[model samples]
Every structure is written in structure tokens, then in C-alpha cells.
Target: MFEYSIKENCLTNKTILVTGAGAGIGKEAAITYAKLGATVILLGKTVKKLEAVYDEIIALGLAEPAIVPLDLKGATKQNYIDMSSTIASQFGKLDGALLNASTLGELTPFTQIHEQVFSDVMQVNVNAQYLLAQALIPTLLLTEKASLVFTSSSVGSQGRAYWGPYSISKFATEGLMQVIADEYENSSLRTNAINPGATNTNMRASAFPAEDKEKLATTADIMPLYVYLMSDDSLAVNGQTIKAQ
Candidate 1:
């Protein structure tokens, strides 16, 4: 678990949108950002889960959060564009966006991979992100300083057997981050990826059911890096992949 003294009110006047905010790392990050005074937009597939997170934030006396129910697998370019428009109308500008929602298709041998599974994984993990980023860039540019954090995996960095489409999608994610980072080198928006190593999340449990869960770090433990990336402290850091452990 990583720890850092969070500067009080570091994210005052900022608006950050987090995908997959219903649970796991995304949920924790949203809570942390709200605690630091950032207005958060919680996006997820399940309305119930998003509402639950919303209620939790309210109970903690954090800033009120907005909920946007969306499933990455089914969202189209127009859907993302509309979402961006709504955000612009409501918040005026976006300070950051965490592309945290992802789907891990069936893990199997390359020869046995199902086409539908592959397509679904790529849709959620890759295409959806590209579309969302494209639509949100205009609003992001409105900020004096903005950040975009993409969720990546270790297997995406190193090809591993049985990792299947998830790994390939992560590689694409890394590439996307680099391209965006380079394109925005002189701009206010900064882009990067973070690998939350072995966190005790549902995704981890699904990927490694046989492993001892107790040995893994909790989602809250890896929040410092998320906070740092969202803060002005990491303004100059771009095109880099950080490991949060």
C-alpha cells in the first residue's frame, strides 16, 4: 500500500470523471478525489452501484457527485459525444478523466478464443476509450491543467499465455496513452497509464482465483498514485506508465 500526506483542498474547483466508479479502484479513487474537494462524476453500467457510491460520498460529507449510468460495451461514439455535451453544459469544463472501466473476456488459448468474446473485450477496453477520449478532449482542453489516466495491466506490458484479449487491449491502451501524451506535449492536458498491481478487487479475484487474496493489497492502498496523477503535482508527467503498489 502506498501512502502520502494529501494536501487539504488540493482538488478544489476541479471536476473529475471516473469510469467504473461503482466498485474497486474506480470507486476508491472517486471517493478520494471528492474528499480532496473535487466534484466527481461517477460513470458505470449499473445504476444501483453508482447510486450506492453516490450515497456513500454524501454520507461522508464530501462534495456531491453526479452519476452517469453507461456501459462501455454498448456505448457508441454518439453516446460519448452526448455525454461530453452534457458535462460541458453542467460542469462547464472537465479537469480530468479516469478511463477505468474495462472488460476481461474469457481467458483461453489463442486458438480457442471466441470471436464474440474478443469483440466484446476490445469494444469495452479499447474502442470505447478512444471514442470517450475523443469526445471529451474538447472539454479537457478547457481546463488550465488536466489529466487523463488510463487503467493498464502488467500482462498488457508483457504477453502471457491465456491472458487473451485483455492483454492485447492493454497494449493498445498503452499505445493510446503514448500517442495522446505526445500529441498534447505542449498542451494543458496530460495523459498516462497506471498498473494497480495485484489489488484485492473483483477483477483480480477473477483473474487469479487460486491465489491467496490476503496477499494482495486493497484498492484504497493504491490511491496515492491516483491522487498524485490527478493533482497539479504531476502536471509535467506525461506519456509514462506508473505502477501503483
Candidate 2:
């Protein structure tokens, strides 16, 4: 498992935004951040799941979390800008944002890829990320130091057969991360990507249905990297894709 010695209350007073916070790695990260003293903003397409996460945070006596119900596929740039403004108004500044939500389109031969699947995958994994990052950058700069993390995959940096649009989108994601990191090299905000390798996520299950779930690393096992990226500990770490294995 990835290791980082996170201090207690390392995220105290931080206001962090987590996309896809209703499930999987996103959900775990949100709860972990809250426990470490951040006021978490849970963004997801499902309102019920977001609410459930909110209640879980509250139940743990962690910081109270806010919810933003949004589907990345249908969200417009204006929607993101307005959401960013609301976050700025409500929280004063955003200390971090985890761009963890992504779509896994069908796994098919290159020649067999559907146009709609490609579009949907690109919309969620690339376009939405671009717009959201654009809208949130200013607020992220408001903090003395901030982290903006994009979720990536092994296939992001390497092209593989039949990975299709998901793989291509991740390559774009890594590019976006690098570009933003370069632009913000001297600024308060830093950008990076995380490649969560072979974890027991729903997406992973769908992609590799025959795999043994018990053998794969759980979200809890890989949270050190997640928490580290959000904490002040990683202020100097930027433009790198750190793997959580």
C-alpha cells in the first residue's frame, strides 16, 4: 500500500471539492478528508448516494459536508462556473479538488468503437474536467497552497488494445494535468494526477469481471496517497502521476 505519514487534523479548515463522491475511491476520499478536518463538498450525479455519504460523514462526527448533485455528461461550462462561484461564496476558497469522476465506455476493438460511447466518455473524462478545472482554478489560487488532483489510470500513459475511449480520455487527462501544472508552477495551486492501479472499484469490476475482488487492494488500502495529496505535505509535489497500489 502507498504510505504517507499524515498528521492529525492535516486538513483542518480546508474546504475540498470531490467529484463522484457517492461511490468507490471518491467516496472513501471524501470521508477521509472530512475525518482529517476538511469541510467536504460532495459532487455526484445521484442525489440519494450523495445524501448517504453526507449522513455517513455526520455520523462519524466529522465535519459537516455539502452536496452538489451533477451529472458531468450533461453539465455545461456555465453550470461549472456558477458552481465555482457558489463554492467561492460559501467556502471563501477551495483548498483542493479531486476530479475523480469518469466514465468507462465499452471495451471493444478499435474498429468497433461506437461514436456515442466515444463522445460520452470524452465528455465526462475530458471536456467536463477542462471546464471544471477552468472554473475552479481561481478559487484554488485563493488558498496559500492548494492541490488539484485528476484521477488517472495505468492505461492513461500507455495505449492498450480494446481500452478504447476511456484510455484515450485519460491520456488527455494527464495532458491537462501537465499543462495546468506548468501554468501554475509558480502559483499557490499545484496540479497532479493519480493512477489508482487495479483496485476494487465498480468500474474495475465492470472492466475485469472475472477477477478476484478479495485479492485487489481496497480503497482503504490506498488512501494514504489520496490524503497525502490533499494535505500540506504534498505542497512541493506537482505535475506527477503518483500511483496508488
Candidate 3:
């Protein structure tokens, strides 16, 4: 499990947007942020899933969360613009964003990777991330200090055999984080990437169906890094990849 020294209620008054908040790490992160006092904006393709998370936060007596049901694979520039505009109008500023939505394209050899699968993976993992960040950068700048944490993978940092477009998309995600982090070096906003290695998410299950799920770290186990990256504790951390395992 990851470790970080974040103080309790460190996220009070913060407004954080979390993509793919319908399930898995994104859901856990949203709940965790709300518990720490941040108003969470849950974005995912499934409204029901987002609503379930919202109810969980409310039931916990945490800050009320907002939901944006968006499928990144089909999301457009205009879609992101509208979301950013809504956040700005509602929250006045965005303190952080967990760009955690990603898809696992088939784990096939490079030569056997399907064209549509490759495009879908890139669209969701790369294109949507770029468009969403481009739209939200202005809102992030409104904060005194802001964080943008992009989800990465072990395969992204070091290519693995038979991972196909999922690995490639993650590589692009890392590049995107570095580019944005460098460009925003002098600004109030900072960008970083986190690799949640070998977690017990559905994606991991899909990748390794035969593995014992109980042996892997759960989403709750690795949330310290997520909370740390989004909190003031990591205000000075930027343009680097942090491992959460």
C-alpha cells in the first residue's frame, strides 16, 4: 500500500473533479476526498453508478457531490468545454482533477490488435484526457494552488509484451502529464501522474482473470497517494510520476 502524510480535513473548501468515478479507484477516491471535506464532482459514463457514489458520500455526511455522465470515448471538445464551464460557474474554481478514466484494450500481440479497439482506447485514454485538461486548465488556474493527477500504469513507464493499445495509451497519458506539467511550471496549477500498480480493480481482473483477487491491493489501500496528490501536502510535487502500490 502507498503511504503519505496528509492531515485530516486538508481538502476542506476544495472542489475536485474525478473522472471515471462510477467504480473502482475513481469511486474510492471520490468518497475519500469528500470525507476529507472536498466537494467532489463525479464524472463517468454511467449515471446510475455515479448516483450510487453520490448517495454514498451523502450518507457519510460528507460534502454533497455532483455528477457528470460522460463517455470519454465519445466525448468531444464541446462536451469538455461545457463541463468546465459548469464547474467554473458552480464551484468558482477547481482545486484538483483525477483524470482516472481509462479502458483496457485487448491484451493481444501488436500485430493482432484490432483497429477499432486501438482507436477506442486512444480516444478514451488519450484524446479525452487532452480535451478535458485543455478545457479545465483555466478553471484550475483560478485556485490558489491546484493539482492535476493523471492515472498511469507500470506498462506505460516500461513497455510490456502483449499489452497492445492499453499500454500505448498509458504512455501517451504520461507524455500528456509531462507536457502540461512543464507548461504550467510557473503557474498556480501543477500536473503529475500516478501509477497504481497491480491493484484489484475490474481492469486488473480483466487482465489477469486467473489470478487470486484477494491477494491484490484494494482501491482503499492505495488512496493515500491519491489524497496526497490532491491535497496541499503535495503542492510542491509536480512533473513527476509517483507509484501507488
| Residue lDDT tens for model 3, 5-101 | 7688989999999999999999999999998999999999999999999999999998889999999988899999999999999999999999999
Each model's RMSD to truth, in Å? Answer: 1.0, 0.6, 0.7
- The residue-by-residue lDDT of candidate 1 on 125-208, one tens digit each, is 999999999999999999899999999999879999998899999999999999999999999999999998899999888988
Model 3 TM-score relative to the real fold: 0.99
Residue 191 lDDT, candidate 3, scale 0-100: 99
Least accurate stretch of 10 residues (summed lDDT) in model 2?
A: 1-10
TM-score of each: 0.98, 0.99, 0.99
Model 2 clash pairs are none
Candidate 2 per-residue lDDT, tens place, 82-105, comes to 999999998899999999999999
Model 3: lowest-lDDT 10 consecutive positions: 1-10
- Write the number of the candidate with greater lDDT, choosing between 2 and 3: 2
Question: What overall lDDT, based on C-alpha atoms, would model 3 receive against the true structure?
Answer: 0.94
Candidate 1, position 189, lDDT: 95
Q: How many residue pairs in model 1 have overlapping backbones?
A: 0
Candidate-wise lDDT, in order? 0.93, 0.96, 0.94
lDDT leader: 2
Ranking by TM-score: 2, 3, 1
Please give the distance, in angstroms, between residue 45's alpha carbon in candidate 1 and its true position after superposition: 0.3
